[model samples]
Target: MLKPEDFRRSIVHEPGEFLAILERRLRAAGSSGRAGPRARLLEKLSTCYQLVDGELSKAEAFLKKIVEQGGFYAELFKLEAGVEPGEVLKRVKALRRAAGNIYASSRSELKSARGERDAREAFRAGVGRLVSIYRRNRKTLSAVRRVALEFSRMPDVEGDLRVIIAGMPQAGKSTLISRLTNAKPEIGFYPFTTKNIIAGHLPVEPYGRIVLIDTPGILDRPMRERNPVEHRAVLAVKHLADALLFLIDPSPGKYYSLDEQLNVYRTVQNMLQGKPLKIVLNKADATPPGELEEACERVRREAGVEPLVISALTGLNLDALKNWLTGLLKTGTRGF
Candidate 1:
């Protein structure tokens, strides 16, 4: 249940901005105290060291926490941003080392200072060195920021029972989730409408709660061939699924043919790794009887399971679907 919101709020500053802010704060502090010039210079240098050290330490800790809690957020950054958490952690450690070196050099320079002017010069030199280090690793910090933003947008799915609703594009996965839980994902006629992972909770009587997650449309293709939206679905299924509801659109004018839908289902099936799965034939209210029957037969013959026929649009057989899910929660079997 490690989620994006669980991460500490970190604001990444650009190299120049970070340097400028530190210098500005130091100057303001240096001008205020009534101590001798040397004492004030020492105060400014100490303040500068604290500022740089604190920023780097907090950032390193944040990255460490994310890597330690490797779950949905870590996989998500890998899939979308191509930024590995370990690599980012290494970069942060590198920056910390550079800052430590600069601070050490500054301390040595101050110890040998002949006058106030020498201390002032050493302080400026230290600030300049830190700025140079940050500038050299700008791309690394940018990647870190991108990962942080993506994590912030991820949906929180902390629950005992997580059921992922997955299918081809234009399948009624979003509508079905809205029907079952309080999550009202944007419903649309076009493909790939549900672009993000949406989580909704259903609190049942006697049993506790079920977290239903609606994922983006997954195409019938290999993992390498999937787009980011499709990868979102895969990540949810791979990491968060306790049970899965693979929806199939059986309408004559369905967005994808039953075969293609089944292919996507097979792809997800492999990702399930033994999680209970249910094949649902959606759009029964719109599908002709022949198409529905053919869809069910194909699922049984090919996918080796009885497809639960339900009209997510008309609320048909939804009670049966709910009953099946609640039964899973009750018995903890979640058997298909």
Candidate 2:
């Protein structure tokens, strides 16, 4: 299986790098052979041909795993259906076949040459053939380059338990993650500050490790209206989360009204598809007592679950919330 991090390490060479690697191998082979001069040249060319074909094979295998194993990249690949995956595969195979034929034809010419000058000319012709092969496949190489960059930006979330923080914009999801773990996601006072899914880890002794995910704010609107970045956040919530912490901002002057925030809550609840969830009322220190009580009552009435109140900024009631999470982990309960 391909984890999200695998994409970063996978090699997607540029045309120059690919050709340079083959050229270096060819030169090394030509210089290292102990056989006669003619045999040495043939050996070098054959080795260079094998090196080029081998790299293509490796690239093909890597792409196949990324597309077929089914992870974040697989989903993205499916979305880019217009850029047929088969086309990339076909180009790779064709490039390899053309390279093999060039090598074979060059080898025949080298053998048929009557003198040293003729053999040297054949060798130069072989190098030209290799260059022509690369030129013909330039577009295919560009496609691979584009795909590699797309996959490299994906977040790597790996652990035994995945806890995703989801809420409307400016709901303190990032702050909560910063406080809970050592991971420091960029913090801002504005909406949609977190544009991607950032992950952190909480090591709870005697229980186990918990991977905490901080996702971009999900607006209360139709899914089709959301941009690609927001859609990626939705994908994290839908596919990556084991449990969700839906944070609610009840401060009087918050960006979204209480009802609007709750609307997003309902939207997220539906998106979770029965995943475990906990509604947390964040920024309690900023909310007035009367308004806080009303918010709590509203959540209880609408969500039918008692919400946890904690100020991520001031650390109020955080210990209690942590204990609650520990208890949940200990009991293996799905919902609170």
Candidate 3:
């Protein structure tokens, strides 16, 4: 029962050791000689891992051999660890793009609706596109936009401001979501605890509605396959964020390493792709005073963007964070 953690720990500094692990897994997974296309592909990937850091010529030769054999792993291996840069680019060009066209068109339609084109039909069509656009990209950003758009159309939920609580898994995402909104998300101690997206509302004054999103944590562990959940959750924030409450944990185990935390943050940041990104440091109670300053410094250096600090466990800074979230939604700036 070897896990990805084993491979990551073993290969942190040595590619050779990593290759050995891959070979052993491939063999154990019944991807041996003369296997099915899938198996053969896995076997080829094993070989690619073995050859990754060797001389460029040697790497090129190994990859060419895999292409000759042909299998699923051939494409995956080539894109991820292919020896030749040109080959990698060729593979990338051929790869099926994710979340294509639908959202882009919706974006254009939204702009058209906002401009002098203020046709009632245009506004109706603009928000209608959200249903199609966001069903696949469920997250706070998407959820908020959908809610806002639909709310505008309907008489019921209009004026609901988006208050997003975003962070990696186990970073108090659910706790904050529950505290801010009426939505209840499954809270757990493990990584990637929430598997589904949960929506709730915040009770504010005047217009007084808040969109609270409880999203599954983005696991930062070594990935054997692309995380579609992570992709969807990230895309939600990227395309749909109004205001973000990003959480950071300075605990031991996987996420404590600033590199790992930053890596997950970058994925979310890339998903946001220039959307307003705010930072919040979670788990201050868990962060010992001795490590607090150092951890904050690490977060400042590595987190994709900067955010405020709050302790979901002790309710420390939660009020301030909430007020900031409210003010941001109301005034279009979180008192920045």
Write down the TM-score of every candidate. 0.91, 0.81, 0.48
Report lDDT per candidate: 0.83, 0.78, 0.51
User: Quick one: ranking by lDDT, best first?
Assistant: 1, 2, 3
Candidate 1 positional error at 89, Å: 1.2
Which scores better on TM-score, 1 or 3? 1
* lDDT of residue 257 for candidate 3: 61
Which candidate's TM-score is highest?
A: 1
lDDT (10s digit) by residue, model 1, range 1-336: 556664537546667777788878887876866787766766777777777767667667667877887876678767765877778788789888878888888878876799777887987887677666767777777666666666667667877688999999899999999999999899999999999989999998767888999999999877788889888888889888999999999898788887799889998999898888999999999999987898899999998899899999999999999998998788775433
On lDDT, the leading prediction is: 1
Better of 2 and 3 by TM-score: 2
> Alpha-carbon error at 138 in model 1, in Å?
1.7
Residue 143 of model 2 has an lDDT of 64
lDDT of 3 by residue, 1-336 (tens): 111222222112123353465456545654445665433443443343333222222323333443553432243233334243346323322221212233345344444454434433443443344232223323322222222232222112123555445667778888877776676677887877766456677777774676766666665665455474554455346434555666777755424466666777766766554545667777787777766677777767766445577777788888887777677667643223
lDDT of 1 at 56: 68
Worst 10 residues of 1 by lDDT: 2-11
